[model samples]
Target: METANSTHTGSHAIKRQGPQQSHNHPLRKDFFDSLSYWLDSPSLAYSSWLSEQKLKDSTKTVYMAMFGRFCQWLNEQGRRLDQLEADDIRRFLDSANPNLPQSRKARTNSGRQRQQYVRQLEKVFAHLSSLGHSGTNPGRIAGYERIGTGSDKPTRFLNREETQRVIQLIQTELDELRQEEKSTDEWLKYRDIAMIGVMIGGGLKVSHIRRLTLNCMDMVEERIDLSQPGHAHRARLLAFAVPAVKAWLSVQEQMHGRKLEPTQKIFEADRSSGFGRNSKTVTLSASSIHRRTQRFLAMAGITGERASAQTLRNTYAGLLIDGGATDDHLVDYLGLQASVTAQRLRNAYARSQLRPAGGAHLSKDH
Candidate 1:
């Protein structure tokens, strides 16, 4: 083991040291060493492991920051990496000081952030064990019993009236766009309408929407194939016979001036030169879809709830359940891997069915 110097800080003192020399010279051992003076060996080892995995630079940066914070916390606790226990990990997440910096407090407050922290720690411990430096993974134990309740935000879904109003709004916008001369804006408007139709009509996830290609749609069959590589659930077909969907596709074909190739992305990024200008095809991001959906929802006067892609998906599920789809049928239609998820959806559907009764029953009887 190589040692450099030690500096005593307030509660946590960082012991600076050089990483063990490796056969791979270009691994940037010093860069990882600088991430934290404490646990330099493990951090450096993890960096090398990450490099071997060929992660992107942004991903590497996030992992490095997460690991550094964990190492700093461990140093404050006076515990070695191998000395960690499930309780120790749990306490670290549960105990938050009000006196801490705003950023630190915010990070601890977020359930999502804590979940990400546990995942990062798990990766580091897994790597350490692989290198024969550790035998146990406390992070995994902590994750199994993770702290914090799941999201409390109410699930948002469009009702019959709201759904019809949104459909009318999209039609109105498309009609206005069609009247204008052919332009990039006109093409993008059609794309947005098409994207919305697929999301609400097909109940597709944002990831599924982004992965859709021209070949995925079967106009003759009036269905869209959603069989993407590496999806958790089995690939299933979705009906796309809705008039909005047909109109969107028709406008898209007109915009391109020809039939799109099988490999071309169905929903693509807007460019100044219009659709299919350059050889490179850029797909719309999830965030882009979300922003556009929010705008459309506002136009339709929908407020006080999330009106994004997921809401549309939930709306689809609600509509199906109302239409007498069984749990097993829902599992297949929604491409859910487990029946338990369908059960949960069923519970949500039951909750949505409850309504206030009229006061006629409470009236005095003669």
Candidate 2:
């Protein structure tokens, strides 16, 4: 058996704590398939650590989802796991708090959530260290102890009035656009409307929109099939988004000057250089999509730190909860990696219902 501090030199270097199987484990089983789908390339070190953990399946699922989010955050910060230190872990925890960058006195206590995250990372680093993958355990008790706990905050989402205002703004614009003859501007507007509708009505992420293909939609059934690898939800009803998407598709067909291929991306750069089979036109970059979504919100008079595509998605979750969706159904509909987000949105929706019109409060939680 490999000792705690023992380092391995070859494939056999990283041994399991319990019985060692004759066949080597593939980096990990498909237990973390969603993580693999979200990541450009899943980390072998992460796989190894998760494979050896003794947690229950439910707990493991949550940790896997949390890790996926952490990896995405690290990418946004332009940091790599191998180069991370305890400070980076701390920064990540702080950033995860939506109420942050404000005075400490104004911040809601999220110590318990932070502590749990630290524990998960600690185990990850410990296992990765034994496998000779990491030099430090940034997720150690020091990080955990430094965090302060608070009651769970409800998720931030638009109320009914705000939701209506946004929808009305978009609809008015679409109606105006329809009055004019077809033009490049018209096509772009249609695309944006479809994007906003999918986000606010269908609850898709910005990343999902960036990678969506034409085949993902089923207009006949008013559903979207995101059943491909990495997505937790196989399909979701489009509900109110069907008309917007259909209109956009019609516009796109005219703009592209041909029958759209199922394999082609649904959204692409406005000034794509080409559109042939060998064309190099690509989907809007993540940043571009985010900025456009922000612009749309701004046009609708929705401006704030929360006036982004994610808020639109959160609003969709709130709508579902208000429409009598169970927490489990909300989780599945949104393809959330964990049920925590669904629960938070549910609570937020409930809180919104309880408040009087003039007594509304905004949430710092995202």
| TM-score per candidate | 0.56, 0.57
- Error (Å) of candidate 2 at residue 170 is 2.3
- In candidate 2, which residue ranges exceed 4 Å CA deviation? 1-154, 183-185, 229-231, 234-238, 272-280, 355-366
Candidate 1: clashing pairs of residues: none
- Can you write out model 1's per-residue Cα lDDT over 1-366, one digit (the tens) per residue? 101111212211111122332343344444543223224455565666666667789988977766666666777777666656554665566556444688776445357767777787777766554444423455664554343223223445676678777778867876676667444446677777777777676677665566566766666645455532222222222343265567666766666677677666677776664534662377775557767887878888775444667667776777667767776656655656456767776776565556332111110000
Off by over 4 Å in 1: 1-150, 175-185, 228-241, 273-280, 355-366
- Number of the predicted model whose lDDT against the real structure is largest: 2
As a whole number from 0 to 100, the lDDT of residue 178 in candidate 1 is 61
Compared with the true structure, model 2 gives a TM-score of 0.57
- Residue 253 CA displacement from its true place in model 2, Å: 1.6
TM match of model 1 to true structure = 0.56
lDDT of 2 by residue, 199-245 (tens): 88888866567657776676775656564233345335446676678
